[model samples]
Target: MDSLHHDLTVVEQIEVSPPHATIGCKSLPLTFSDIAWFAFPDPVHTLFFYDHPITQTIFIETIVPTLKQSLSITLQHFFPFVGKLAIFPTSTRIPEIRYVEGDSVAVTFAESDLDFNYITGNHPRECHKFYHLIPLLGSTTKVSDYITIPVFAVQVTLFPNHGIFIGMTNHHNLCDASTRFCFLKAWTSIAQSGGSDEPFLANGTLPIYDRLLKYPKIDESFVKNANVETFDEEYKLPRLSGPTNEVRATFILTRTKINGLKKLVSTQLPTLAYVSSFTVACAYIWSCATKVEKDELAAFIFVIDGRSRLDPPIPAAYLGNCVMPCFTLARTTILKSKEGFVTAAKLIGQNLHKMLSDKDGIVKDIGSFEE
Candidate 1:
């Protein structure tokens, strides 16, 4: 199933502002965690394709307006989005992300004639095909000046007669996956209530926007002690880093198969009997992707939420970035060997153990990963 060549027609662009007057003259400082993501892609593209259960009239007359209204009401609590990044060069402090009145979020309503099953099927399809369904972070061309950047953009495309797709592109500096998920859940909850008092707060789905709540736990000793490139120094390859030619497709393994993989890893490494499905999958994929040069090191780097992993857990309502990195470096030759999968799995398991059990913290001492 594939919609490799589907037509996407953007019908309307609406700015959903807060339902009530938002208090202005407020600014939230960018946490150290947020500043590090200045150059990275907004962590995720939240996309989902849902089957059409209502007639076009109901969808257009009832669904769209409700969603837009709910979004506006939701923004009342998350008013910072109506804000923009405020930067000062001479200040020792981090730039502030500010919110102002009349600021609005852009939502595009679109239509597509693409085959619903083909576009949302469980079969292998071109990864690029799904790119269009998700809207870009900002509507205008890339701005060298960071002050004017839009932290969020949303797209809603209806696959007429098939299903409807809603995609939101969010900035990492604004919020992480957990926060985004909470916002989405809140929006739906409000919509489900026919736009009454938000059901999220009643259900305990709240977001903490104060940046100072989650202090930077990353130890800077690594950057200060090690003679490494600072955040600004880096090499260029003349072109962006991406596979211009390669097989990039999604894979879904059933629970039984996942259990089988975990069992296989555990059989080889007794200590990693509780390795997660993600660790197992990464181990398998890394082993398959390596060419094994005996000396070359292949690093499997992944991120974990630091909210709960930190020594003193952060508030559940905190909405900004709090991700920490955990990595495993293995000799290409070892990864290509018969015990390759187990070797990689053990490294990941060890990292997780440290992240969870280490008293000092797995997020201590960090350096830039810029290339």
Candidate 2:
């Protein structure tokens, strides 16, 4: 199967219109919004499987028409922000990405004979993933508010075994992690619906970033208390006061266990926050790992999407990042407490809620800091 792996060829082609008359325009500077998207953890490309095979021909035939219709409608209604870096020639163009010669987008069809079990262990092998920057990864459509993002999928063969395997990749420019998932699910639904009533819009109206910027300003105070550096500088780098390596561990919490936690917290003195389950879980796990008492200081940093909080509507589905962080604090003593997990969760929840809606919340704090 290992040799078969290399045998799998990734067929690529771009679906786009004619190129610009000339090449190499001036370099486009990134806007505040553009930098906002870049600030997020660089999006990771994912590999997953489909229960059935839709031949690339069939998929292309089926998907293109629907996409054309949807893209037309989307551009008219929601001006998506695909960012500027990957646009063909110079970056300042209204549309961010374009297909020039020799560039191809990859698509796939499921094959039963190919190995589908390319999945290695609980997580897919990092080496198996493909990393490429879509030159127009997020270029908006030349036709206003719309943008065409290139998504790629490949089949893989692991070991000498021959069974069908599929892999998909997309440049992060067009969608944040959440938007990526939204697009995938939306694509599947649209495909299933034959493009009827595409469910691409977020439930609520998207907030307008231009106006919302007034509330949350950027500054040193907006910077994370944790060490700040370019992602390249942070790679394999230890946390400011922590070890060289950070390990990810997972656990499943059953409803029964959740009830037990609730019961335990009710019996404890301070009211534990019901909101911090995941945050508290992290604290507990970390505390156990270090074999230290619970009272030590730990921070829970997480994102809060501000779409609904904005004063005006922005294209909710615009293809870029629009997330802010909320940091929670927990003491080691709280973790060692009898209801440590629940306690941490409660405190985390409180802080998270306060960060989002408190009169003097993080947004306001950041705004003042920027001033």
What is the lDDT, from 0 to 100, of the residue 87 in candidate 2?
27
User: What is the per-residue lDDT of model 2 for residues 1-371, given as tens digits with 9 covering 90 to 100?
Assistant: 11212334333332322122222222222233334443443434455533444555544455444544433233222223211233222222322333333233333332223333433334433332322211112222332333233332223222222222334444444445665555555545444555443454543333232323433334222232212222221132111222234432336667776566556555662554343445445545544543465446876676766554433434555445556667766676666666566556566667776766666664453344455
- What lDDT tens digits, residue by residue, belong to model 1 across residues 125-222? 66656677777655322224333455777888877667799988766668777777777777788888887644667885567766544343331322
Q: Which prediction has the highest TM-score against the true structure?
A: 1
Task: Please list the residue runs of candidate 2 whose C-alpha ends up more than 4 Å from where it truly belongs after superposition.
Answer: 1-8, 11-34, 37-41, 52-175, 195-250, 273-298, 310-319, 329-340, 362-371
Superposed Cα deviation of residue 104, candidate 1 (Å)? 0.4
Give candidate 1's error at residue 105 in angstroms: 0.5
Model 1 residue runs over 4 Å out of place are: 1-6, 39-43, 53-55, 139-146, 212-248, 291-295, 363-371
lDDT of 1 at 151: 72
| Residue 367's lDDT in candidate 2 | 41
Q: Estimate each model's TM-score.
A: 0.82, 0.54
